[model samples]
Target: MRLSDISIKNPVFAWMLMFGLMIFGLISFSRMGVSQMPDVDFPTVTVSVSLDGAAPEVMETQVVDPIESSLMTVEGIESIKSSSKTGSASITVEFDLDRNIDLAVQDVQAKISGIQRMLPDDVDPPSISKTNPDDQPILWLALTYDKEDPEFLMRYARDYLKDRFTTVEGVGDIFLGGYTDPVMRVHVRPKDLLRYNISVNDVVDAIRNEHSELPGGYIQTDKKTFNVRTMGEAKTEEEFRNIVISRRAGVTVADPTNMVKIRQVADASMGLDKIERMSRFNGKTALGLGIRKQRGTNAVSVARAVKEQITVIQKTLPPGMNLQVNFDSTKFIEQSVGELNHHLILAVIFTSLVCWMFLGSWSATFNVLLSIPTSLLGAFIGLYFLGYTLNTFTLLGLTLAIGIVVDDAIMVLENIFRYNENGRGRIESAILGAREISFAAMAATAAVIAIFLPVAFMKGIIGKFFMQFGVTISIAVFLSLVESLTITPMRCAGFVHHGERKTKLGKGFEALMENTRIGYDRWLRVSLQHPWKVLIGSLVFVAVSFISIKFLNKEMSPAQDQSIFMARLIMPVGTSLQYTDQQTKKRKRGSCPVRKSNRCMQPWGALVAVFLIPT
Candidate 1:
């Protein structure tokens, strides 16, 4: 049978089948994770290593150089850069865009480990950290309290907060900074070391030996084992002072005649000391919390997890202490996504209403609505496959698409109705109407998709962010056109029936369209007869539009909706006393009066030479 014969025979069954397809399409969309922007990962990796007794130059030569040089031989490694600071070395390796990070890291590790014995003894093994900046902290918080001490905050964060939310499925890690415990410091004077003929190494050994408590060898007297130990260790500074260094019997190293005593050379003490200052928030001493999301994880989901954990821990915080969020990507993502979603729904609803009004049949409306869900689902499926996202570009394209997708449906349905009015049977009209314009719809969709191809080819950061959107919408619109030509025609053919009747509203709509065409005919006739007037009027309109663009203040999208709006006026535009009086009257109602509070702003205040901020 011909394609037309199939559509004419069973259009409603075809409609039902398409509905089932839409349900499957919904399943495809559900598998997608939500994010604010296009999902992509840069190809980069970092090696972190610690070096003891090394300055920056020494660290660069001893640790950073060896690692970077070794990794340089790894295949597909693009660029290798290293930073050597006080006691640590970080070497970042960037790879080509197509390189797999996991494989690259494995290759680097295998090569470095094979040459392990060659590295210095004091250099700890280098750790390959995943280099995606998307996995970096998406949220930052400042925790502050008056009564809580640094030790208390430090203990609370470590014991209760950091691990709880960080363990959430998509959360990478949570870091707490600013507050640290005072560490135990053992400072020994250099004079004491010389006085006792003891070196710094000896003092270090003494401290290490005195602080530890360990079990010694067991004794086997009477078949009952007993453990022995050397007990005179320092529990406090006083105890360390009395820790005997040399015996009165002249127990000497290398058989020396010098006798040693505990007080002969050095003063040693155990006390707590602060080593490094930490970062503070807003000029106030407070602990900062940073939350990182796992790679390929949902930003919004991890943020929600952090909040839930914070809620549970809020009860345990010291009085007046709280975690205040300073930065949250989720806020902007949720807002922007929510607005786009709202617009999508409104567009769909408005389009559906318009379609129903024009068709005046419930069955026709239902069939048109079927394409809405299917188009969106198919778009998401394409996105999932291609790694695109529902970001600004994709959404804007979808918004632009609200009118295009339904054009085929409207045209096909209208033609079908037109055939029905010609006294042909329902099945015959369905077949003829669908066959007539399927090619035209396909061509228009091709044009739409073609417009975005150049957008996909755009370069740099801006291009990277918007390319996913461009490709997603491009593919979606093309698929929609195909579906409209193929699936839509098949369904419309089968659903049309012998007994179907046109509503009065549809007939009226047809009459209005007829009247509009007649009006256009008259306007064209008048314009063609007066070419000079037409040319002059068009020129005037163009000039006015140019002037508007030059003078008016415009923004790309709508600002937040509110009951009030404000305008700031500077040394600008011509006005009259009547306009100024009107503006003053308006300000008296709802606007706050602007105050110039700086004494320097006064003309007679000696005009002090001060640069508050360099111009």
Candidate 2:
């Protein structure tokens, strides 16, 4: 028998196929991991150089110009934008979207290595950064303690807290920002630098050479092949101080005293000099912690894990030091998705009521209701396979398509009812309905899928989030079409009521349909006689379309503003605690940061009160 004939012959098998699709969908969805967004990478990178004391002009001449010139020959480069600031140079390298970002980074490394010797030896190795939404911090925490030196707090944040946070599954990068790591800094004196006549290069070479680590060549003499190695990792301040500088050329052939200790020559340059205190939380001394999540892990899950870990770690903190929660993206996702899910459930119930009222028979209504879950389950299965989510957009798309998805079931049932009312057999009515409207149902499904074609073609950020919604709904509507043609008819074989005298519920619907028909006929008759008026109305609508296009503001994605807020901090070279506290306390209500220093922190910017802070 043909598929439709087989479907008409067996309702149980049809339902089985539907559940099979559902099971497959659930499996696929489980396999797909959660992510902030899909795995589509942009072809862009940022390179930053820390020339701490150099002016913009000096960085431009010494750092930026050489790097840009060397990297100019990279493949697939679309454009280059560079900036030089008070203490650094930043060059943003943009490439074609189709290019591989990893390969581009590799190319940049090669380019830099080729010109390394030509650039200022004082400059640090340029760091490469990839541009991705995933790079955005998933969470920010502020740590504060009572009158403690910032170094101690930073050490706790790093040596104590950092390793634990990094070990959490799904965490990407943990950064200890807004403070120093508390290290002993050996300040090099200017007088010693001049006396030794040490160029910064000499100091750089001496330190690197003395601190060099080497793997040894093993010696084997039969009894045992023992390993041999020499190691060095800055044992003490004195070790760093006593490192030897090269012998100077003797003014006299036999003169023997020109060697210098690295400490003597290095004393001229100001080094990390006892970890300068940096302020976090708006000029109040604090240590800051940031967590970045790994891709493909659910944001909701990762955020919860981070919170739990923080709670566990809080018990270990010293008295007075506390952790302040600053950012949590998962909270927003959970709340928004929960609301969307509630609305979707309501939509499903309302749709089922519509089907039951129109059919006015328990058995017939059951077929249509079954079609709804079969369609929905099938759609989600498709979503799982496609690596999509039960997100706001996808749920909204499914909700919108609900009316369309049921249209097939309605058409099939309408035909079955019509055939049965003519005194046809139940078996004959089922087969006839399937045969009669199958082509029309398929055409309608095709049209719905066509509507989403443009959405799939959308490119860049906005497109990435939306295309899945469109595809999920389109697939669902199509599957419902298949059910309407095959399964609905088979289920109809055992049940289609036929009688001239109408049941009480059917009679009410019949009367309503008559009223709707009469009202629509009235409008149809007037429009048929006045084509010119209809044409003029079309012209007016077309004109309004142009006006809307010109007046509307545009954005790359839908604006999702939240009542949730955040705060940023700035500390001038020497902002005091009492002053910072006063400034935080004096914030004007509902404000944000402004250029004026006298203006207190914004109302949204919490003063980071010491007592209530959470670890």
What is the C-alpha lDDT profile of model 1 across 384-476, one tens digit per residue? Answer: 666554566677777767666777677777787788778976667777887887777778777877887678877644566668767767766
TM-score, each model? 0.66, 0.81
The candidate 1 region of ten consecutive residues with least summed lDDT is: 599-608
Clashing pairs in 1: 10-494, 11-494, 11-495, 12-495, 192-265, 196-265
TM-score winner among the candidates?
2
Off by over 4 Å in 2: 30-39, 97-118, 145-147, 179-181, 188-220, 238-284, 318-320, 390-392, 494-510, 566-615
Candidate 2: tens digits of C-alpha lDDT, residues 430-529: 8887788888888888888898856866775567667776787788898898888777887788665644426776788879988999999999999999
Q: Number of the top candidate by lDDT?
A: 2
Candidate 1's TM-score reads: 0.66
For model 1, the superposed segments whose C-alpha errors exceed 4 Å read 2-16, 24-31, 48-53, 88-90, 111-120, 178-183, 206-277, 281-284, 318-321, 349-369, 381-390, 393-397, 436-467, 485-487, 490-615
Distance from true position, residue 48, model 1, in Å? 4.1
